[model samples]
Target: MLNRFLLPALAATLLTTACTEPPKTVAALPILGERDVRPRADGGPADTVYAAVPAFRLTDQAGQPVSNQTFAGRAYVTDFFFATCPGICPKMQSELLKVYKKFPTDPRISFLSITIDPDHDSTAVLRDYAQRLGIGDASRWHFASLGDRAKSFELANHLLTGVVPDSLAPGGLAHNGTLALVDDRGYIRGAYDGLNAGQVAALQRDIPVLLAEIDGRKKGVAKK
Candidate 1:
């Protein structure tokens, strides 16, 4: 319901039930076709194109340096999370963990769990958090430090895709469980709400296709 990017829920339900196949069950994503999950940015005639990522440096869960440069030449699944959240964070994380395990042996893909509450979700806190979630592997999956509240908030607005931090008062910032797909060139290819198992599975299926596309293109160029 949060993401009406597809269609009205009633229509979606009707369409999904009318067709047995997952591809035909749902409508076309803003960017991906019924069967294709790889972002169609450069492919032309795809759903949409992504904007280039900006340059910025931050820390990792291990307190190491990380930047937009960090994601360059790599593909990954990214999401925003906080150490202390009650509403959808738990369920959302549960779903994301399913995705983390999906590509257990995938060397070409990585996972980026960016914490919105950087102040509370420090390196040690994030490390503990990952352990609690039973994340697959540290090397394959990572949690990034989003700097301070000011920078994190700004980045979310600029990127127009992540987080809504809260005030220290009564309630917290409104959070969404969307997982973003970033390409090897540091461009955002697509996004999905990780709270939905069906959507997550769809995303899992698409990642390999995107990787294969890039790899194939590289090979073709090398031959030329």
Candidate 2:
């Protein structure tokens, strides 16, 4: 009789404790890409070095050099497109605009749309294109053109997108509508299909997560 009563009481106490405990937190977004484990100089823990976006300078709409340094300390979403794209460009830009509108005034975020047809999409052309999209702040929403068409294609590859000159394709160029989310450290954290609403929604959800992790790191707070 004593054992039966004690077991029931113990079970009830355990159930109550479990119900009152705090909920578990969602873990931080994983840093995407191949990483190398290296020993720290301070002899603490081994550091994992992730692959980062290579440095390249692009001529922005304002004819300014937009390089990795330009986006220092800020997370940016980048996509490849040409100003004259008649097929997917318009749709992709419209989708990206959704993300831009979400953080238009956010100082921690920026947008970069690189033109694959730089020879045709001049600085003035890009500026007008941006204006048509209601983007007045070039610093925040940069429509940049890289004059070296081959280099531009190479850069797109680094962002996990492909760009090729196809006369049969729209605007005489072929490209994927991939929106890549890069962290402040220039690492590719996420990539989404700009043409797909569902993937874009995931991108929207992830941007804040990365931003929150960055902020927490700065404040010496751990992100769960």
Clashing pairs in 1: none
Best by TM-score: 2
Q: For each candidate in the order shown, give its overall lDDT on alpha carbons.
A: 0.70, 0.91
lDDT tens digits, residue span 17-110, model 1: 9887655343222332123335575866655444555676767766777776666666777777778877777887888788778787687788
Task: Give the per-residue lDDT digits (tens) of candidate 2, residues 1-224.
Answer: 89999999999999999889698696566667678999999999998898899989998988889999998878999999988899899999999999998998999999999998888899999999999999998999999987889999999999988888888997888899999999988999999999999999999999999998778776774433
Write down the worst ten-residue block by lDDT for model 2. 215-224
TM-score of each prediction: 0.71, 0.84
Poorly placed runs, candidate 2 (over 4 Å): 1-21, 34-48, 221-224
Clashes of 2: 0
Residue pairs whose backbone atoms clash in candidate 2: none
